[model samples]
Target: MAYKKETMESDCIKAILDNNLMFQEDIFSFVGFARSTYFDRSLDKSDAIKKALNDNRIKTKHTLKKKWEKSDNPTLQIALYKLICDDHEFNRLAGVKNDITSGGEPFDIEVFIVNGKNKTKKKD
Candidate 1:
């Protein structure tokens, strides 16, 4: 049995919004549509489906940001930081020592590098 385009599109949109899915496979799986059929019908190329996924992703990010801001949980804070902070900031806050020297001895190097930047390392 073949499904109507409208039915398939609506089902895919609902699956995306409801499941907060951002990937094509997850959306098609949740909606019980075959990946090949989805691609063949160009349902994967639908602008509506793309917009729904992007919008839902933005909404989820905003929700998570708000929750992270108000909560004092260290895990949540770290998770959000990992999501938003650059590699340098994350390493600094997490106490990740990216020491390139093989031994414990401090060598006289002209430039100190952290996350690809050559400057004085900030005290965490």
Candidate 2:
């Protein structure tokens, strides 16, 4: 007996949706199917069955925002500035300066540098 492409796709989608697997590769492995087979039959459809299955998947918006906030660490930012000013040496010639302010302020930092004989103010 042979199953229609749509039926196979729905079955695959059911397996994928019910399983604990989060990644495409993991789902494919769990079902003992090839990537090509899984994607072509399911993920490749216009009304992609895989998309419907994973529709309720939680997004990592909070995690990413937290990481971004960490990356914007004031200490790290200042350290980078100091490193640039000390190591680059040319920053002085380029007239690069670090001016930072904090707390609900309009801007966190203001950088004044001479660019082609004109003073440029950069806000971060």
Candidate 3:
């Protein structure tokens, strides 16, 4: 039997959106298609399926961003900061330890925790 695009397209879209599937192989597997069929049918090139997958992924990202924004979790806030902030700002906020010296010697370290303020400690 051959795979029918007309019959499988809707199922593919539904599975993608329902499962929040982001990978082509996962989507094809969820829809019960062989890997060879996926390539032979050019399912990767199908605009409808591609659009559905991209849209679903973007929608999922937006939902997660919203949740992260609305919550008061500092970990998530720091994670979001890491995504948007420059290396300097992120290091300032999350703290960075330079544990190796230019001379290849162990260096003192300062660890910062996001518990409302920054704290520092020296490595023993």
- Please write out the lDDT profile of model 1 over residues 1-124, one tens digit for every residue: 6978888999999998888898777876687768787887889889999999889888988998999978899989888888889878978988886876669677777965567855588799
If scored against the real structure, what TM-score would every candidate get? Answer: 0.58, 0.35, 0.62
Q: What is the model-wide C-alpha lDDT for candidate 3?
A: 0.79
Question: Cα deviation in Å at residue 90, candidate 3?
Answer: 4.6
What's the lDDT for all of these models? 0.84, 0.56, 0.79
* lDDT preference between candidates 2 and 3, better one: 3
Show where candidate 1 strays beyond 4 Å: 3-7, 86-88, 94-124
Question: 1 or 2, which is superior by TM-score?
Answer: 1
Return the TM-score for candidate 2, rounded to 2 decimals. 0.35
Where is the poorest 10-residue window by lDDT in model 2? 56-65
Q: Alpha carbon lDDT of residue 121, candidate 1? A: 84
Worst 10-residue lDDT window, candidate 3: 97-106
For residues 18-117, write the lDDT of model 2, one tens digit per residue. 7734445565655545667655655555365547445635434344445545786876545445544553464564577454435535574677765656
Worst 10 residues of 1 by lDDT: 111-120
RMSD of each: 13.4, 15.6, 14.6
